[model samples]
Target: MHGRIKGEAAFRRYVARASDELRQANYTVSAVDLIVTPTRTVEEVILSTDGPKGRVDLPIAIVTDRGPGGLVEIRMYFSTWPITGEHAIRPPLLQHDPNVHEKGAVGDYQRALAAGDLAATLAAFEPQATVREPAGGEYTHTGTAELTELYTLFFSNGGGIPLEHCTVPDDGRACALEYNVTQWGRAAMPPEAGVAVYVRGASGKLIAARIYDDSNPPLHRPDPSFAGCVL
Candidate 1:
């Protein structure tokens, strides 16, 4: 039979250390309670906490094996609860890379236009991409080569593409960017026009893109003149 003992000293020490670690890692811990089993082999810890989005209830258990020397293993479980308060939830440390990717994509597009880097701009787009313009028709292109040709003509005729904002979906599968363009030509252009571009990617490479603009229904115009155009 295994001997049971209440080792309060050891349990308190472990809880203090764990709490400090969690705080250092930027996790908000509140209302913590710790209890050590009479046998001193199991410790239960509970706390109210919040994550990047909302509040949660976290319960952790530390188990010590029966032995002459003190050895411990800890396990943590998290559950969310409805709480009303202003709490800033912390983001996961391991998710920095994906967050960086999203920022990079937005920055790339902005830089491309500011520097007039056409090649770099196109490089940011997927192979099979579709572009919709406010007064212009939709153009679907299959590859980089075709897209470049279209961009070349558009820029040659004195066109300006300006991005306003982008939204990354929570699922991380797609992004929608809002932009405007001004074309200087004999034809009169609207004072303000916008385009919403929806993009899907895999492994950081764009695989599909579709654009929504004023030319189609939201507007009373459906110019089909630019059909078969790529870019």
Candidate 2:
């Protein structure tokens, strides 16, 4: 808890405070992600903290409860379990096909991803939109809250994941894009190739997305989509 727990702003303040405190204590913190949903708040911070003993790598997950007023409580979960996952993340191995025209929304996504513009990237999605990552997994992301978590974690660790398209389907209702994502730092896995499907809503904004890629379970496959995707 940071403040009187007023609203989302207060919640964000708490997050900033947490990061600040960690840094001030000679602990270098790299945030993995932060999720502030209607009922829950979770933050994943990777810390390299030093003390009398020495320096150690710590993957820290901080969780908190959320209420109408704001954040409620906090806790931390740690594990000796190592972080491992394979992904085909790199600068687009192949160039974007000159002949293929890209969709506006999809194109915006690609540019935002390259620029590491997290907020701009998120603004492309509808509030209740759903997203599936580049690698097929047991989990799917739905709504703004989940999306926030997905991107937050990604931009924190994933760095600038550039995508060079090999294909962009002509179909307006459904478009599939083949891409290569960039691997996160220090926590590197195998390279990954991904396909993302982008579908438009009646209002013409992206409403749903699904991804298919070679990323393994341990690596966090945040966003990569457009082929073999279902609406």
Cα lDDT tens digits, model 2, 31-145, are: 7444444465555566676644565555454546667876566544332212223332222334556565567777777667666577877777777888865322334688888
- Per-prediction tally of clashes: 0, 16
- Predicted candidate 1 versus true structure: per-residue lDDT over 41-113, tens digit per residue: 3333344444555544443323333334555333222211112211122112111122322344445754564
Residue pairs with clashing backbones, model 1: none
lDDT of each: 0.39, 0.54
For residue 38, model 2's alpha carbon misses the true position, in angstroms, by 45
Report the Cα RMSD per candidate.
20.7, 17.5
Which has the greatest TM-score?
A: 2
Q: How far out, in Å, is residue 162 in model 2?
A: 0.7
* Lowest lDDT block of 10, candidate 1: 87-96
Cα lDDT of model 2 overall? 0.54
Model 2 residue runs over 4 Å out of place are 1-101, 134-137, 182-191, 216-231
